[model samples]
Target: MASDMLLQHLDYLLALAAERHFGRAAARCHVSQPTLSVAIRRLEKDLGIVIVQRGHRFEGFTEEGRRVVTWAQRIIAERDDMLADLERMRGRLTVTARLGAIPTAVPASPFISGEFLRRNPAASVRIEALSSREIARQLADFEIDAGLTYLDDEAPPGTRSVVLYREQYVLVAPAANHLMNAPEVAWSDAAGLELCVLMTTMRNRRILDANMAAEGVQYRPVVEAASVDALYAHLSHSGRATIASTAWLPQLGVPAGFAARPMVQHGPRPVIGLVVPDRAPASIVAAALAEVADDVDLEAHIAAAWDAAGDRRG
Candidate 1:
């Protein structure tokens, strides 16, 4: 069979692996069930291997068949990338930028997406708030095109990255709360307030815990939530404060009667940035977004916002 024809059969095999059923895989590929089955058999014959386990229905692939599917994903991905590159050169690459970001880093999504859309008017980005570990998992599974996350020890290995900014955790509380307005607030001091904080399972929370623990302080929050948004809701309704990264301030702003105060420097800043797969991106739109990330001065934008609102103690 011609190379393109063989690749099409591989596509059918991949679809079967994903759907795990013959009829459904055929429907997904928009081909008849028999057509898909024949293609798989042809693929097996061309390679002289039993790529699929025969059964009354779709079962599974042999070991070598799994390897073929893996390489097929790569092969199809690179082919699509090349075609997208050609389209981009002609200014017609329309794509959706599926992106994931840790809740702390969600504020930076616009800085990345704004420039990306401006450069490619035909593109769009959707940002989902997720934990750092979830972001890495999604990237590995090709569930998202790119991610904004802590680039320190938390970043997954075998990924390519460009650091955007060093995150500074700050105290967000009611402006009328005189207990926290100072040049800076120490962790121990912040720990004594009515508090709502992220759950310990989150990377940001772990870092916060490690920092305060080093000072012989342990944060026991009045409310512990799993996500930044949850913590924000608690702070808003319960009239409490949260120790969140500076990234939160520029995006959500403090709720009414609130301000953001710098925390005392406790350790190295958590560098946050854009990360993508080490291999060719599964989507050309992702490649474009990563390229945009490399050039955008998100650090400057974030710093300017932070400086403008430094200790908003009014």
Candidate 2:
């Protein structure tokens, strides 16, 4: 009974760490602030350490609190894994998996999700578009179950990655635009065009910037957005163009009056993949996701898109 109570207290601490506000944390835990406060105080007393640095408002956690938070996350994750393993052993696996992905990888997610659902009909899934760095952070925090992002990017320590596909680049432009008739456009040529691109903070944008720089192309985006949808919306309304993964076009369809063409002379195609924490006895959902990922022929989808882009260009 005491052990179970301690687990509940750890839940409160995790909520506080995530929300950074006592009121919000209590709300998340569905308990009164005072209840959460007392539980935390009790936990601190039992642990013999000052966890939170409290004041008139919720101050940050002490160093000990941060360490405790890490332990709490590990313990909670292990608890979940144990439950999942039991369910799997009973041949009744139920799970709600969260997946974080980069904007460019969003198109491929539906296929992956569909496959996962087919395999685990009892499972539910949520996919969020996040930058690579954000995905790495969320994975470390155990806020997300897995991530689909570039494999070469800096990931948190103890991250296990499996390559999915090499992203193929395409230029998305208005159909009437002169560049659309070309079978392929060089990065330097595309750079001269008025562009609508993702914000610099996103890894996709950084990759584009680096590619353009390598090609000695001087470029400035006319519009900058944080989401792929926003960039597409801008492209639809304006004559400006943007670089996007070839996989995006099939899922989103080239907007009416828009054309997608393969980008030639583009530098290396970055390998994107599924990443998860490298923990022993991985969570059931994570293990299933990885198994499904292995069977996903991402390159085949990209190849089909390549053909579609060529057809659109012609």
Candidate number achieving the greatest lDDT relative to the actual structure? 2
- Across 164-244, the per-residue lDDT of candidate 2 in tens digits comes to 888878888888877777878788989987898889888889889888888888798999988888888887667788898
What lDDT does each candidate get?
Answer: 0.80, 0.85
Q: Model 1 Cα displacement at 204 (Å)?
A: 1.3
Residue pairs that clash (backbone atoms under 3 angstroms), model 2: none
The per-residue C-alpha lDDT of model 2 at residue 50 equals 99
Relative to the true structure, candidate 2 reaches a TM of 0.95
* Number of clashes recorded per candidate: 1, 0
C-alpha lDDT of residue 239 in model 2: 78
Model 2 is weakest, by summed lDDT over 10 consecutive residues, at: 305-314
Residue 140, model 1, lDDT = 72
Residue 150 in candidate 2, Cα distance off native in Å: 0.3
- Clash count (model 1, backbone only): 1
